[model samples]
Target: MPEPPPTADVSTALVTGGSAGLGQVIAATFADAGYRVVLVGRSSERLDAAKQQLDTQPGRDIVTLAGDVGVREDCDRIASTIEDQFGRLDVLVNCVGTSDRGLAGELTADRLHELIDQNVVTTLLCCQAFAPLLESSRGSIVNIGSLAGKVGARYLGGYNAAKHALAGLTQQLRLEWRDKGIHVALVSPGPIRRDDAGTRYRDRTDATLPASASAPGGGTKVKGLPAATVARAVLACAQKRRTDVILPGYLRLLIVLGNAFPRLGDWLLLKFTS
Candidate 1:
């Protein structure tokens, strides 16, 4: 039988794609919780700006790294840097992902590949590179997912596929790393309320898609969750070592119901979205 995990309190956390958007909010959430936070992203300027924004709290240690985590070399370099600087990592939150809008048939191979790189590859590379450190600390990893990952919704293009792949990867890593004492979890949430929630995907949609298709959750009737709410769930998942969490928690029942009765599931999904 495998031994139980250590009870040491986690101190340091690293969030990938942490320079802006939901990533920055998650970083702030960790910092607010008194964890020494490290934010990684592709743009040095954006990293610097994020650090400034997050450095407001007294005694909050915010470290920013500029690198593309999708690249293995960059992931290796970041891991090495973290080891040399912090010496331990108790939590890793993969908050990097991109959404798309279009019909499944219209989603070209190249576009699908791009979405995969943005959503799946980046998380995989970061998790692979950081596993050693997390192993030493018996840390937790929370991979941010979307509602699209749990159930298919129309007009999301490659997002649903990419997020579904991420959902599978999260579960696989949790099982594979169980003996290694790493807790991997997926926090699949509905469309988050953001400044650009209603129109972020406008440029990605075309005449074939409804204007509402550019809205959050592709015009799904579900309300947008606050960024802070999702961040809190990520924190809870790590601190509690949860297996899987679906936001708007009630959705879990729907997902299960859908799995059990495919026809009813299809009906519920179609009814939920415009």
Candidate 2:
């Protein structure tokens, strides 16, 4: 692989949820581009697998940390480990999140809390833990959001609430830290086509919607975008210091329409989505 541009001085990126899905691709892309990358995940096995894959980028530095970012103690350890190993962090990618599709009434309190802890709390804790290092480096943060964050969809109440909270936090941080020389941006993508059957959630529960509503190429027939697409968009966002990026471009229209016509948006979403 070719070396990164001479002008690129930023190094060291920490990506949560890097063991799989879009997070894995993002870590690989950064490593290939010569960034010292750290992959954080809950599963040691998956982290090891991801590290092995990124290690193929000759001469690139890769570290795998197995811990849950949703837990404060784990986040502290992760921050300390990065600071001790790298001395400074140039980028922080908050890619730790999960998705679920079920009617609000069907979701138990425990399930709702799980979604919040997995999605919203994980992002918040990581950001809080790493903010000091990023501020010192005058670095950037790229948060992975979702289209559900911008506009609610059928049978995704808990996920939508959590992602929307994440989106709000991203914007608030962007403004709050602007003067501190920390650039914060959000990358919100629609359904992402994972290598594993393009399923949204890692597991299917009894409360989940029918497979037709949850699987890619099922109801709406909208084939999800490749993971690499979002990874590249993240690179661009980091390089240009963009404020927000909604993937596939056209989804931006949905956000606008949803806000401008709430009733119409609800009708459209119901009519089109399974």
Candidate 3:
């Protein structure tokens, strides 16, 4: 745990999925910057562990609420709790999402629903519940999206579709809430490396990777950006209120080229894999 800044001004920040991964890092970043952070997650045990880790800094307040953001009532509770306790929200970071790699043909209806509930519905409900508080404070929202949302991938059909919906939602919120003084932005990153990366993706049976995914790496040692890097980018997007941020920077060019020259973009994608 890092120490909060000595002279930093205080504010309130709510981070969903703050128990682990990128969300945890983002919550820590905000706490270090002197915000009273409220962490939301589904697992009480994990939330307790996260609270213990983040509550070390003196004078910095950290609260953890265990609830499913996919449920509307749970989201409402989160909003009410934050409102009664903090009165205002300066930041809202929506990071409660899951990923799955499966071909469209093999994906079951339940799996698709699960993906949507975990990713899109959670985001929608959280934002809807927190909007009034955010509006009161002229706060900012940072929605966690994915690189798959920008460009389609071979075996991530369901996850990609959900992320694409999130991207659209981010844009819609940005447009719809501009007059309300709420800043809305999206952070779309490439694959994030986790501590248990190998085991995390090992048990999946429904998806087969494209040759390109394993071209340079023989095994399942997929390369990815550090979660901390993505966390920093999330803060930057919130502070700057940028509409959309695509990670690695270079991916933006790929998106542009892909849109402008579809066949050439396909050739480039193939060339990279080959």
Which one wins on lDDT? 1
How would the candidate models be sorted by TM-score, starting from the highest?
A: 1, 2, 3
- Cα-lDDT of candidate 1: 0.92
TM-scores of the candidates in the order shown = 0.95, 0.89, 0.89
* Worst 10 contiguous positions by lDDT, candidate 2: 198-207
Worst 10 residues of 1 by lDDT: 3-12
lDDT of 2: 0.82
Cα lDDT, model 2, residue 88:
83
lDDT of 1 by residue, 14-93 (tens): 99989988888999999999898989998999999999988887767788888999899999999998888768899999
Query: How many backbone overlaps does candidate 2 show?
Result: 0
lDDT of 3 by residue, 126-179 (tens): 999999998998889999998778766555648878899999999998999999
Q: Give the higher-lDDT candidate: 1 or 3.
A: 1
lDDT of 3 at 23: 93
Candidate with top TM-score is 1
Error of 2 at 231 (Å): 0.3
Q: Which residue pairs collide, candidate 3?
A: none
